[model samples]
Target: MKACIYPGSFDPITKGHMDIIGRARNLFPKVFVGVLNNPAKRNLFSVDKRIEMIRRAAAGMDGVEVVAFDGLLVELMKKLDCRIIIRGLRTGTDLELEQQLSVINGKLLPGAETVALLSKPETYFISSSAVRELIEFRADISDYVPKEVADMINGGNAK
Candidate 1:
């Protein structure tokens, strides 16, 4: 079966990321949403919490699974037998960075390929950093993130 791995820190799982995942699900037979734990980045939610949030967001999506992992993403792709890596591009910078990452991943795993999807124009401006900024100001995050994430950031029942 054709499978793809979508990897990201997913610190809080934004709506923009979900949009890409929904589209990718339609394209691939099986899609694994891999929550990456980045040591260098400070996250409001722990890795396990992020995984649970993503899992709730992805519930009822057939052939979709939310998982967590550390270390090189290329290795996870190999372990999962994911030939395609799904990446979301929000701007020119995202494209450039994805290109660089794709090249590096390609070198690390010659069998892997990266497929990028541009974020929907309406959600193009949405990002994890932007979400965090909004949260800090107590701005409504319901529209920017899934209900679970919104609840978490808004001091409601998220778990």
Candidate 2:
């Protein structure tokens, strides 16, 4: 029962996110998509909506479970009994930040490891914030996010 956790805000699941989820699923028998419910951050969509969008986007991905969680990611990992954390790296900045988090997470939970996956070139430039900006301007975000997410944004379901 080897499993991994991919934690993120996932304000609205983007194609980049789906790509990482797909790739992670191929490596681990179970990949739990942990959607962080951060009360401090103002999100365009609710955590429940984000989970719903992720579930729809990853519908056919076996072993991929979408869940809402808060507090420390290490805590979530402990709760799920997982030791591997999957993170997507798009740029050097991401590498730096993720590296720091990885070290901290390892210290918090010994034996826990972080796996960094490079984003596909096609989705390297896409981000949840960028997608939100596009949505604010009423721009076409079909290419930036999953169809389910784009549809949700286009349908004005965003909070």
* Highest-scoring model, lDDT: 2
Give stretches of model 1 more than 4 Å off: 155-159
What TM-score would every model get versus the actual structure?
Answer: 0.93, 0.97
Predicted structure 1: lDDT: 0.86
Worst 10 residues of 2 by lDDT: 150-159
Clashes in each model (backbone N, CA, C under 3 Å)?
0, 0
What is the C-alpha lDDT profile of model 1 across 1-159, one tens digit per residue? 999999998878999989988999999989999998888878877888888888878887888888788899988888888879999998899899999999999999997899999888889988888887877787888888998777655665432
lDDT of 2 by residue, 1-159 (tens): 989999999977789989999999999999999999999999988998898898888988889998889899999999999999999999999999999999999999999999999999999999999888888899999998988888877887776
